[model samples]
Target: MKAHRLLTVAVLVAATACGISPTDVQDRGNAPTTRIPPPSKTIYLLKDGRLVLEPADVDNDTVGSLLGALFDASTKPLGERDTALRGFTYIGIKDSLNPIQRDEVQLPRTSTLTVYIRGEGTLTDLGKAQIVCTAQQDAAFEQVRIVRENEDRPSRTEGRYTCGELK
Candidate 1:
């Protein structure tokens, strides 16, 4: 009887992970009795000539494993936690990169890259836009700045991060 119960639980976990809904599970107790949401927008990643492809946000529970989820383990798609934490991004690399040039794969000393974003979004009263930045970098670091708008004391903040290339 104990072995049977363990098997049942294992099967339940596997079914859920495979995108099966609780309602779809038969021979189970209460059909799981839980719900999770999938992601909205799809994204593509390219770094160091490597391509990384990622599906949309995916179920809220799995958000932590998504490319954007690398920013936060407990973050929802575009949800604001500004009063709590600063966010970062994960770069996408879909496929392996091959070398096909006269140069023998020599890396540069210093290269600056600028990404362009063209889309509509919501703004906070403090005037900061929430965006998913997916890029590759050698190390992770954040800068803080305090800006006073309207004679109010400037508040400390995490600097904007760019994640798309190796430094």
Candidate 2:
């Protein structure tokens, strides 16, 4: 009887150790899966006329997504004193636009990034510089450009300028 009792206790312990608990044995098909998105891209934001690179872990690698990360207000910069992009909305993705008469689109194109703004407002020169600098950080894009929808054109092109060059 003692040997039998010891064997039962050992079996129970081994089962529990093997993750055979009754609760854990229930079907887990509906259980929520916790997945963490890995950081795969770098972006630049503006603060005091200087560009700061920030790491972003996003599900999508589109131009608009990168812009969204750069403009996110909650992101903390490397330096406590650094600030993020002031005014910009991630509209969507697009390939073509009219320079004279533009409309809002998000995650537009790898070569050309379109921004959606609210009301009659637009991104300042410094803001555009921030966008350009941030977009260029991605290796996929060779000459990333910024186009503000229903807003004025940026003062400089992407390849020709840097965030530090902004004033």
What would the TM-scores of all predictions be? Answer: 0.19, 0.44
- Provide the overall lDDT of each model, using Cα atoms, as 2-decimal numbers: 0.33, 0.54
Off by over 4 Å in 2: 1-40, 74-81, 96-110, 119-122, 139-145, 150-167
Over 1-167, each residue of candidate 1 has an lDDT whose tens digit, in order, gives: 99999999999888789975555535745555665433333333333333333444544433223434433431444332221113323332222223334466645333222222112222222222122233222122121111212224443232343433121
CA RMSD, predictions in order:
19.8, 12.6
What's the distance in Å from true for residue 101, model 2? 23
Clash number for every model?
A: 8, 8
Task: Write model 2 residue lDDT over 1-167, tens digit each, in one string.
Answer: 99999999999889889865475455848879896542347666545666666666555866667767766643444454344344445544444432332465444443443344332344566666666666655444434345445445543322333444553
Off by over 4 Å in 1: 1-28, 40-42, 46-61, 68-167
After aligning candidate 1 to the native by TM-score, how far in Å is the CA of 150 from where it should be? 34
Error of 2 at 88 (Å): 3.0
Best by lDDT: 2
lDDT value, candidate 1, whole model? 0.33
